[model samples]
Target: MTEAPATIMLNGKSRKIKQPCSATELLSELGWKPTQVVIEHNGQVIPRSETGAIMLREGDQVEIILPVAGG
Candidate 1:
């Protein structure tokens, strides 16, 4: 079987995920809702629809910023 693409970092660590994946798919894999997390690629906020359109590649920097409610 062919190898999948290398993992993209969540914050500063390497993340290993199978290939043929998109931003939406990644969130699904983590069991997180699109509303719960914010995705930043190359320092840009990508829209939800763009998730499916944006295919991940090796050495790509992905920062998944999420919100937490607390008082």
Candidate 2:
């Protein structure tokens, strides 16, 4: 039997992703550049170096924050 897609809360919205994927893959899927945003997974800040190693699971809450540019 095939496994159901993983559903996660992304930026306060519900997003369904095919299977469990790494945070890096999630970023790519969303067309987001890792260097341009800060990732908070399950209420904890995830370091850029560990983004590739962290696996996204069903029901996980992810918050993506974009940095603001100022003059």
All candidates: TM-score: 0.79, 0.88
Residue lDDT tens for model 1, 1-71:
86677777767789887786788888888898877788897678998767778777777788888777878
Best by lDDT: 2
Candidate number achieving the greatest TM-score relative to the actual structure: 2
Model 2: CA > 4 A from native:
none
Q: Clashing residue pairs, candidate 1?
A: 7-15
How much lDDT does candidate 2 score?
A: 0.90
Worst 10 residues of 2 by lDDT: 17-26
TM-score of 2: 0.88
Per-residue alpha-carbon lDDT of candidate 2 for residues 1-71, written as tens digits (9 for 90 to 100): 66689999999999998775889999998899889888999999999988998898899999999878878
